[model samples]
Target: MQLSNIAHGPEIRDEAVAFCLWAPLHQRVTLKIEKRGQWQMKRLADGWHRVEIPGARPGDLYTFILPNGLEVPDPASRFQPNDVHGPSEIIDPTFAWRTEPWNGRPWEEMVIYEMHLGAFTEAGTFLAAIEKLEHLRRLGITAIQLMPLSDFPGRYGWGYDGVLSYAPDSSYGRPEDLRSLVDAAHGCGISVFLDVVYNHFGPDGNYLPHYAPIFSDTHKTPWGRGLNFDGAGSRFVRDFIIENAIYWIREFRMDGLRLDAVHAIRDDSHPHILCELAERVREAVSERPIHLIAENEDNNADLLARDAQGRARQFTAQWNDDIHHVLHIAATGETFGYYRDYAGDGAKIGRALAEGFVFQGEHMPYRGKTRGRPSTGLPPTAFVSFIQNHDQIGNRAMGDRMNASHPIEAIKAIAAIYLLAPQIPMLFMGEEWGSTDPFPFFCDLADELNETIRAGRKEELSRLPGFDVNDALDPICESTFRQAKLQWRGAIHNEPFVEYYRLLLSLRRKWIVPCLADARGHSAKYDSDGRLVCVTWKMGRSILHLMANLSGEAVDTTVPNRKDIILSQGDIAPDRLGPWAVLWSLAQE
Candidate 1:
């Protein structure tokens, strides 16, 4: 098997360890293993430095020494016991067999539950997260998607601002603890998917800028400079990201990965970095199925399309922001910021249901340009839809969930659309029970960068009308982190929406899952005058219809006669629908 230069990070073999570092610009590099003194590294062709230490083993701490007498932690460190600035420790990659025969669950059977390890439980450790998996299993979640865990500088973060791509954040416990979580999740018949960021690194504790030309000034991102994926010294950078993807799947047994913000990954190279990454992952996993998802803001349809050879070009699914935007507008009737492009009406939902993206090649007034490609050719299962996620909820000035902004009936109606639709569905943590706790944007940053983050967050919130910039919660504050943690007991007992979610998920598995494979079998319609959105889905011989009234006032409407009434919530009459009434029935033709 061929290996990338970044693939070998302190590989322990037969009582000796081999260390490899790509330092083409530097004339000399030294391997400084703690307690073992320093050993000069031999410079190889193409700017790589290599050294073999006989006594080095799995638990050793090491750093690389430069000609200027400065020492830095390994860029591809597997474990950083002393945080991001400390020496990288050699961890035992070996684990006992438990989920060996586990081929992950099918993508078609997936109902994803997105979670934050720290915010999901009171203890905020991987083991603590394991204790709550049974609840998700009972809720009928087939997959769990965790936010980024890459090692960052501070004690708490959203995980996007990570410096070390290889190491799991030690704040979440040891790397072994993470392994146990995945192993346990598989034992419960749930697959684990990780969200990974490769567009840029965090500001603090990011030593790659000094060691190598790892970033480019050509393309700028909101967070930082874009990664140099197409310029000089880009081959190694591409390998670095591809290897990181494989490491998570091979080392920790992760079932899949969700690439964060691929629109920022600007690469003009022929075979795009995303395509190469997907191909490498497929090669690494061999015959075992692994899911690859992308969060593309541009709404490019080709991200999930196949090449001429019938090979998947990039990912299995792309996070469908259009669906969420239209639903949010219809539910809350707020047409500000990016929501202005979507009309807050029931017809928008019907359009999204029939065609994949309502904004397909249409000129977007908010951006003053065309935004998305035609996604009608793409399968509905190729898009992941959700009403609320971390970015949509937490990026708000108050970090309010959808349940907090809209009425209970409106929330339930939107929930039914997302869950029962042909597109893949994901639930935010604690969203099942409509938890009132705000998922505010919180991060633990060093003092030097604290004010910058605070000011940036405040400026972003200023775009929303009537929002007080001064009253926004500090992202760097400890209280903000505490406020985001889920109060599981309170939400489960007090919130009635929990039962709504359970019933929807049950119906999804029994009725909707079978029809997701064929996008043509689904159709939707809506009447603006009646304020009603109706969807009809045909699965083999079983036909199902879902009608929802999103208006505040009761709506009188004609109802088609159906024999099987699978599920009905709120007011459902033969010809009239009370405000926010959603009814699901099976029709015989």
Candidate 2:
């Protein structure tokens, strides 16, 4: 079995490198450390090679040598010399950590708040984000899921194009800034989850081919060629990736890693890279519980299934885009993308509650096949559901405002789905009080990689209707990211919106007893005509009914039992109102 090791180089000394390279077909592998003069190496066996390069360090460059004459550097190196075009550089993990040992909240108790740190603030540095941890904590969010911080080309991006796996993006401050962000977040009882892009590397900074065989033309993803996880010389490559996953949990003190686009990871292995990575992180965090959440669009419940003895080889959970599908269908009444299969979105919402999956193995007209399998027995905590996320917002032509499209009343209905439902609720940053920000897909690429990114973004958006190719590269100006920042002023002043979000978050934190039961009892009931759908939070004493008025006009709504007014986005908060008129009512038998 390949193990993790520490390697180093010059410019920085004794840098810790958890190195791995693809040399599977090769019986022997040699680690090479190159510096001022000639490079030196030591041969290793088991199709694996590892050694701590003592003198070599961060800013110093090095690569690996396989029996096949392939040379690569520590795949887990935080920094790469030559800007991802050259060998990997070591990064020391001994930076001062002030955050004491802190155990994170339960999966069911967690309210994940997703943010793109680069666009979350004006400065857009990790240090800048650190100043905002207390804000998220006060918002009733238990976890902060950050978009990718790994080094990508240029100043801005969606972070899916990261090339350097180990280092934090220079635009977001150095590695130390990221460490400070996580530590500070921990201090305020907020667990950090970095959305990691493992599917592919950025076009500009990517030069993995010169190091080892980590890319394969055989299996192409929607973005590009899939990672080389099972091919020849892939053992080391797999190790490099799996170790990088663990590096964040063990070293960076992150509570979890949100694996970006797991569906794009095509590996033909008996024990796939995903399984290996989960187990590796499990072992790495044996002393503390850490999460390895994958963002898989594959509506498969087996994606979260565990092995015997309750050891999860799969992901902790995935982003439930299906929830967005159902909510969008319910609110906007559109059936595009994977939402074509939803017969009744209100029922789909109910299915999300009862079964813990929205796309439950139904014939999906969008994919022309049965899409997700039924997850009847899984915990509601197995899925993170949200009405708006980066993908939903950024995929638009001008990135139209989410709250702008739907009525303020209907917007509250959508948020109530996640907060009231059993599934783990996630809020896109600025979603609480509805900050007017359009998170458009903007990236800064090197001059050489400009055409590559342009063509790639254009082709990807081409499938969508009426997508403008000219909009792919919107010019990565400061205004690009500036437009995405949250307007806390609006949230603070608007007592209604402020109280609305606070009420939802506080309500979720107060009554949603993850301990009472799993997501087994909740059932969604609604129709195609958009009349009424209900979210029933089943409890031992009282079952809560979350009713939504799909149409523009008020419609007569009914629940399982009597109701009372709890909250609403309409003109007046209902209190001691008639049965049908009560916007939010807590009732009993």
lDDT for residue 435 in candidate 1, whole number 0-100: 79
Q: Ten residues in a row with the worst lDDT in model 1?
A: 518-527
Candidate 2: residue 181 Cα off by (Å): 0.8
Q: Highest lDDT: give the candidate number.
A: 1
lDDT per residue for candidate 1 within 1-589, as digits (tens), equals: 2446445578788979999998877979999989989999999887889999998898899999989888899999999999999999999998875877888887878999999999999999999999998988988999999999999888888999999999999989998999999999999999999999999999888887766889986988988799988999988888888999999998888899999999999998867889889988989897678999999888888788865543456798889888898888777888888887777567667767656687888888777898888876666677899998999888888888777767877888888878877788999999898877899899998898899999999988987664677888989988899999899896658556677788888988987777655444444443454378876656446566777787788888876665576667678788898887777777545
**Can you list the residue pairs that collide in candidate 1?**
none
Model 2, runs deviating above 4 Å: 1-39, 43-74, 80-90, 306-313, 336-345, 466-479, 485-489, 493-495, 514-530, 537-542, 559-589
Any runs in candidate 1 off by more than 4 Å, and if so which?
1-6, 306-312, 519-530, 537-544, 586-589
lDDT of 2 at 207: 53
Q: Whole-model Cα lDDT per candidate?
A: 0.84, 0.68
TM-score of each: 0.95, 0.85
